[model samples]
Target: MVIDMQKYFLNPVSHAYVESGPAITQKIKALQDCCLGRNIPVVQTRHINTKEGAKRMDRWWGDLITADNPLSQISNDLKCDKATIITKEQYDAFLDTGLEQLLKKQGISQLIITGVLTHLCCESTARSAFMRGFEVFFAVDGTASYNEQFHLAALLNLSHGFAVPVLTSEIIEQLESRT
Candidate 1:
């Protein structure tokens, strides 16, 4: 699952931009390509705020990614034509989104998470997925945040209990070995 890899957080001009966005974009793209080649489903999440769902986020951040914003769109660097796009309203992608149901329907018991805001959406989703009984593999190199402190802090916290922190190359190697 790729969480919120939109231009809102990736483009340098954006207020929420992560410095490592470009590097992680390539890492995520490689992971996605490997998954696609192996017939492993790739689920991409777009965080958007609806009037009804924006209350908490609006209050906390004072900003929201509405549907009409061009930055809300997924990054151009990633190929998502074959991915299952999940439009989410909260940091946790599973909330109010049909993500859990969709994964179950596809017989997917594990999720490899990658994307921007490692300390926010990505970490939140990883915790949520673990609580929901899904094994989560968090892509350490394929996720980014506004700064290294936030990024490393999230990885440390998540690795303690919520997720298995891994490199993109490790994931790709495992996938390649499977076939």
Candidate 2:
């Protein structure tokens, strides 16, 4: 699952821009391509705020990504046409987003997570997925944050308790070996 790879977090001009966004975007694209080639379903998440859902988020961040915002759109670099797009209002993708049900419907028991804001959306989703009984593989190199410290801190915390932290190349090699 790719979490919040929209321009809101990726584009440098954005207030929420992640410094590692460009590098991670390329890595995520590679991982997505590999998944597509192997017929493994790729789930992409877009974080958007609705008036009702933005209450808490707005209170905390004082900003929101509304549906009409161009930055709210998923990055064009990703092959979204071949992936399932999941729109979410919170940091946790499974929160109010039928993401768990969608994975179950597709017989997907595991999720490889990638995208921006490693310390926020990605980490939250990883923890949520783990609690929901889904095995989570967090893409260390395919996720980014506002700074390296935040990114590494998230990876460390997640690896200790919630997820298996892995690089994009390692994931791709493992998938290739399986086939």
TM-scores for all candidates: the values are: 0.97, 0.97
Q: Measured by TM-score, how close is model 1 to the native structure? A: 0.97
Show model 2 residue runs off by greater than 4 Å: none
| Tens digits of lDDT, candidate 2, 121-153 | 999999999999999999999998888899999
Error of 1 at 174 (Å): 0.5
Model 2 worst lDDT run, 10 consecutive residues: 10-19
- How large an RMSD does model 2 have? 0.9
For each of the candidates, the C-alpha root-mean-square deviation to the true structure, in angstroms, is: 0.9, 0.9
lDDT for 27 (candidate 1): 88
Which 10-residue window of candidate 1 scores lowest in summed lDDT? 55-64
Give per-residue lDDT, candidate 1, residue 33. Answer: 94
